[model samples]
Target: MSSGKGGPGLPQERKVVTEIPGPRSREIQERRLKAVPPGVGSVLPVYTVAAGGGVVVDVDGNSLIDFGSGIAVTNVGNAHPEVVRRVQDQVAAFTHTCFMVTPYEAYVEVAERLNHLTPGDHEKRTILVNSGAEAVENAVKIARYATRRPAVVVFDHGYHGRTLLTMTLTAKNMPYKEGFGPYAPEVYRMPMAYPFRSELDGPATAAQAIDQITKQIGAHNVAAVVVEPILGEGGFIEPSPGFLPAIAEFAKANGILFVADEIQTGFGRTGRLFACEHEGIVPDLITTAKGIAGGLPLAAVTGRADLMDSVHGGGLGGTYGGNPIACEAALAVLDALDAEKIVERARQIGDIMLPRLRRMAEKHPEIGDVRGRGAMIAIELVKPGTTEPDPARTAELAKACHAQGLLVLTAGTYGNVLRFLPPLVIPEHLLNEGLDLLENAFGG
Candidate 1:
């Protein structure tokens, strides 16, 4: 790793002064067991004290190289200077004006940015919300309100969120949808054109999916077709080429809305402003969160003006929908995203990471597929000589990496994909260092 030249407040090296969850963190974990519920789980529960650039410092003074970015939330880095400054200033001025009550310009500015930056160039409108689930639920609400249709088409191996409606929309059944029952109705699941597994090419897969949707759900009854350009929690699956365009085209042809859930793929995570851009598919509505506000709780649904306007003003807001602090942070995030060259950085990261991961796959027979774009990448783990999911190996490898002071996240419906979401600000040397740690963990 680089000796110095880390970002402002973080070092560029992985320094493990103690064992991975040292005595101090272990004590905290005991307290946490008493305070926090078992249902609320964590991949790594070591209790972070400070984080920035590419490293998370734990309570015991060990610095672990971050690959999760809090699940793609810290794209611009933790405690980004401009974001911190803006939030500090805004907090001092007034923490909460409650945009729905007193109103604020920061909220409006964020909406304007979302309207301008999202896929569409046409006249658009934006509504802010508290989380990605809220954005998604609101998108569906708006689509139904506009189209007066009941059925909403979703895809397999897609994750929306944990809210009642979004949990139903999510494909996985275990943690997200298990005990939660009576999911929101009128949400239909469709086949996704995952390139690695599907036999058909992109266009054929799209055609097959469209045919199934037409026969099963019918064109006139569908309100929207909600999809993630790159299925995030579903193993970073990049749907085959022409799949998204076909879906978007069918949605439009039938007067149904196309909603692109960019919650995990937005703000340069996928080497583009939005992953839909990669397919040249301009969606009718786009949901964004995570990386948008530099770790603040914020999400938005930006859409066509007419569709958004159909909901009426009073129908589409919450008291804390556009919290002033989050808005200010988001404004700062946009500025940093542009000024720091984050989009370009994402592409550069992919350039460095993809080759290394492909090389690793070559060495490790357990690696089934290395897929995804930009900083949002994943390696699907499978049994040797077959495509059966190897979640046990994935967990073992993750534990080994954690022991070595590296943080990685696992994803996929089968829970066998190791996803890498290192912050765009992560120093190249630190990233390489983290990858080296992974190589060692995997016995390379």
Candidate 2:
């Protein structure tokens, strides 16, 4: 694809030099079975030796076009120049002084940047953490502390994380929650405004959610209403119009903190700087991670100053919460996001992908619905002539894409959605080529 050439290091083109899991990868997979637990799964079996631009070079020398940016973690690319430079410099200077131990300027800079970037103009505060789940848990902790309430309302088809509390918050039961109990208590599930499958429209869905929360959990007893503006793992489900605003309004009216989980849709992953911006919903608290720090482990909870400051200083920190290297990486990521005009690039990607996928959907009856915004897009597959989920077909299509050197990811509570998350730096030609491979996979 694209003349089988690359600038330097990892290429920007896809080249299938061997079978999907070539001999080398197969060999490594054997070792992995012994070393790694089966519970920790991977979408692709090929082991990556190096990755950059739009391709991942596996140990077998096959260059696959990356459609899943490590589940939206590498929005700026896997090895962004500025991020690499900052991380290297920080590592050389000192890897860890521990933000909670000695403190660091980069951490403060990152906090300040998040406070300014996340939706909302009012005075805000931020606490840095190590992962999306940590950010979410901390956000709930802060909300509960500020409101002195016990109940936290989440939505059906939502996925927060694998931690005890987040697992309870997540809606999917299979791999995330089934046997993990006893889960954290006080987390209640509500109906989501999924446009494709829902019987109700946006406002009606909001009404149902509000009514359920009011009747099931008393308004005064609820601490927060956590939502993903565009649900990520549960599928790139952008709730119908007017849904988020109504929910936010109801939350405010009831004194329930509205928390937007932008972990997968933040830092230019979506066309906007934040997905909530698309709906004009200003959440009382927001959780961010993944794309926040290139590939480094980092997350944050930015919220209203009063709510954030409610918890005592010592009550909100970790030994490696804001590791200096992660902070430096985050700082670089924020700079790249603005300097490279990545948000605009994300919009451009959405412009290219949405139309292409919609056209593809027209040709394939198996594709039930194509949805999502920006680089974060997905297509839900269904049984022929019906709306029922077809996870088997979804898995088969993903396997076909992988065989053709296109890396894609699957999501949805039913596991019937094919999701894409190309890096912001991917060239247009590479994107087109990847889509071509996907089209061929569909045909096959």
Candidate 3:
């Protein structure tokens, strides 16, 4: 199938006018402060006026090489023509009918695509939601309903969402979970295999973790074990080779559902369509959001049909769940992913980025570790020799990059990991340019 065309086309090259934020953006910021909430923090002072392919043009006419990809949401690149057209057409023809009342074909089609795309050959079903957190919350509900158990297991440093239930599931304390308390109960935390810091290898660490959990919590009492194949907010840490598979086996033996939170690692971000595919292990349930709709707000839980069916006919839906426009945008994203070879492009990005990051780690003693899968990569900053996190240095580096026209994000429980989620469609030269800025930030 040919890629559909719509939305504004990408410019041939990036252009910078005035400084990074420029004057117009500063003016807009001043205006925004008068009306907008103070809770929302501005990263780079610039406000995006247009974006296509791999670049974002701010209101001040400074075109930047987009490295953030809107927090890894636009894997197919910003305003992908096909996605834009599909969304545009969808908006024109009945924007909202409340899928619970008058369902649409696009919703079903998107679900079908997810069922087919997610890891596993077994019969699978899907439930679409508005965001990654909603998908995770619903997945937990399904698991509990299916097993008749109350407790759900999540890994340390694993980030599920910001919702009440997921906040309890999340490992970080400050900002996301601070004072947001009275979180939903029955959520348990377990240590994930952090090879850089752990004493045991992959399988040994997995075994140790499982043993502790089963002994303390009783695996039989747990409804599900949630993990990120490649840790997202927890510094993009990839579980040691045997860790995930071992955990999967334990979950299966204990009759607990294995849930893979692929909100950040799914949809070709990690070379494979799903990060779990690397282990050839199929999770009982997979939660996905970012990159699935190429920028539209859409997320889903794809899982074994039997477990999914446990929920009553009307129990597993939302009023605006699976918005038709978002569904259409998702379908377009899938088409672009396949026809445009985006999966391969993601692999190419990883090939270009990993080596450069590794070299950076070699030169900078502050870089404690460089890790990730595919393009979903990160470099953790430490206080040289010690594993002690250096969030202050991470902040400095990010600020430096931002000033020089690159946008980088910091993650990890300690907030000392610098993650790169550049668009797969970004030109090779532009990728190198971003890397050069990063090198300069590190004192190259």
Candidate 4:
């Protein structure tokens, strides 16, 4: 174990002052269970009192190294000094004038920043929303309006969100979509490149996928083809090298808008500023959230100026879409991301994490595949020497990690993939410490 600096007002060492769900955390959780809806998933039983840099300090004073980044919402780190200060200053000036009602300079400034930051250099426009799902839904609406088509294509095992329209876009169907749909119609599912399990190589895989889509869905009728550059909930699966480019080519030929869902993979989570940059494929539209505003609720859709403008004058926006507070927080987050060299840190994190995960995969036959880009990584667990998934063991392994002070998340259609979304601000030694716990849990 090693000790390193964690911004201001943080401990030099991780101190477990109480048990996993310490007395204070349990008390707060008891109250939370009664007040908050059960639909929201709580990973660990502990309730966090404070967080900064890379550590989550529980109510009972147990400082645990945060590997989940609040589900990748704090890539610039929790309660970042700059973000906190900016949010505080903004809140004091005005809480919510409602951009649609009175408007604000912060909102326009955020939109300008997003226009410059997103993939395309072509003239672009942005629409800020309150959540990733909202951004995605709006993207679909814009695409359908612009293309005058009915069909939307999404990949198998993809997760868009829980909203009705997005649930139709999502592939998984249990808790997110089980009884909730009766989903919106005209969304189609296609196979994504999963090299570890699929038999075909990169180009072949892309060809077969495009062929199937063209044959069944008839590309001309498709309004948009939405994809995650690096599949987030679908086990952190990165598309084969030629896969995305082929799909982009197909979309171009068919007059389909290509939308990149960067909710989890954007803002330097995948080493590159955007995962699509890794393959040099630019989408017509990109949906962003999670780490975009550090920890604030801010999501955006940036796309070709023409397509984004297709919506009628009053068709886009919400009352709280681009609240001043969130816009200010987003600006601070962008500043921190640049000043702290977060994209480089993501690459550095991958260097430490991937090798450790690969070693675990080698020793454990249950680990079917190790994959992902940069800090957004995953290990797909399976029955030894077979393709059969082992979700039971996957859950057990996650529990083991949690017990040992490491927080991990599970994903995949079969729930057999363990994903790691550590904050980019996590210190080298602290990240290794989390990995050491993972190693111990895996019996290394």
* Candidate 1 TM-score, C-alpha based: 0.98
Candidate 4: which stretches are off by over 4 Å?
1-7
> What are the candidates' C-alpha RMSDs?
2.3, 2.2, 3.0, 2.6
Quantify all predictions' global Cα lDDT against the true fold.
0.91, 0.91, 0.88, 0.87
Global CA lDDT of candidate 4, please?
Answer: 0.87
Q: What is the TM-score of each candidate against the true structure?
A: 0.98, 0.97, 0.96, 0.96
Residue 397 miss distance in model 3 (angstroms): 0.7
Tell how far residue 82 is off in model 1, in angstroms. Answer: 0.6
Better of 2 and 3 by TM-score: 2
* Model 4, TM vs. native: 0.96
Tens-digit lDDT track of model 2 for 115-157: 9988889999999999999999999999999999999999999
Clashing pairs in 4: none
lDDT for predicted candidate 1 compared with the true structure: 0.91
User: Which structure is stronger by lDDT: 2 or 4?
Assistant: 2
Query: In candidate 3, what are the lDDT values of residues 1-444, reduced to their tens digit?
Result: 112221346563567667777888899999999999976776687888777677777777667777888888988888888887888898888899988998889999998988988888899999999999999999999999999998898888899888899889999997789888888888888888898878778899888889888888898899999999988888898888899999999999999999999998888999999999999889999999989898889999999999998898998988778999999989999998899998999999989999999998899999999887777889999999999999999999998888787878889999999999998788888889999989999999
Candidate 1 residue-wise lDDT, 255-295, digit = tens: 99999999999999989989999989999999999999999
